[model samples]
Target: MSGRCKGGKGLGKGGTKRHHKLLCDNIQGITKPATRRVARQREAHLGAHLRGDAWDVAGLTPSHLELIYEEMHGMLQVFLENVIHDTITYSEHAKGKTVTAMDVVYALKHQRHTLYSSGG
Candidate 1:
């Protein structure tokens, strides 16, 4: 009965139509290249600050160091996601494709500049 329809946000409760629309909207668009580019730049800039000689190049302030570390962590997460995406799209059917920590290490060494330039 209508009395049981306690609708509003979230699951099978109520507002079911709106929830379905929201889900569709979320899935409708492809990820934008510009957005990915911005993410890569942010990561790389933060990375530059976190490197070993950064403090010597630019005096280390405690807060600045913490901020750099936080940015680096976020950038690493984004980079990892890209790596996973690339593997899924390009090598998925190649057989026995596994992404190990070493895979990330190798990818970073070889692909970092290219990925940054192209906005991966």
Candidate 2:
């Protein structure tokens, strides 16, 4: 018998190779108009909230509001950073590619900000 295998299951010498496009090319499908629309919507929503009754009740001047906004934003940023860091740590420890609700719950619990039990 010949040295060659009977079946043609072996890898062929010549075939058109599949070329995957770059990730950036795929991301380019989200056109500029769609991005602008989302930005405009967010701007409008934020403007409405800034002009809303909540701020009206506070009766703070623009300067005072700006100061408070900066302080509150800084505190929120720090809090979010801590929570996200903890969440990512939990996810990495569990060898999970995606963070689940349980990971978040556990992270919050670890930080003494427990939301709810894992069980129903």
Candidate 3:
């Protein structure tokens, strides 16, 4: 097996009937770093920084980053969807137009005030 990646090995009916090779190339992918950007890692770093003020982050590990990243991303996705949906509904019915960036900004502002406007 050469270093070049291979796919679909055929071995059936004396090489007459080609059988699809289910396990061809390595399923785990190459050992080297992936060329694509990993968003989860980036998200984790942001979360670590956000909490660094109150917690010691000098000994954080890759696994910890991934766990925090997953939770942050999961919760943010849900929150964003809800925010966008509410803004879209209001903008469409009230203004009779498509949503815009201002809609998002307004939604965010409204949510912030609604949730965090306590005596200040």
Q: Per-candidate TM vs. native?
A: 0.33, 0.50, 0.43
> How well does model 1 score by local distance difference test?
0.51
Model 3: per-residue Cα lDDT at residue 61: 91
Estimate the overall C-alpha local distance difference test score of candidate 3.
Answer: 0.56
- Report the alpha-carbon TM-score of model 3 versus the true structure: 0.43
Q: Which 10-residue window of candidate 3 scores lowest in summed lDDT?
A: 27-36
lDDT of each: 0.51, 0.65, 0.56
Q: Give the TM-score of candidate 1.
A: 0.33
lDDT string for model 3 (5-49, tens) is: 566545562355557687533423422133113343544656865
Q: If candidate 1 were superposed on the true structure by all CA atoms, what would the RMSD be?
A: 15.9
Cα error, residue 47 of model 2, in Å, equals 29
Error of 3 at 78 (Å): 1.8
Q: For residues 1-120, what per-residue lDDT tens digits would candidate 2 score against the true structure?
A: 786856644467546777967543233354545544644565676786544453341476778865755554555457667988999999999978799888888888888976755741
Per-residue lDDT tens digits of candidate 1, residues 56-107?
Answer: 4148677876576556556656766677666554444444346554444445
User: Which of 1 and 3 is ahead in TM-score?
Assistant: 3
Best by TM-score: 2
Best by lDDT: 2
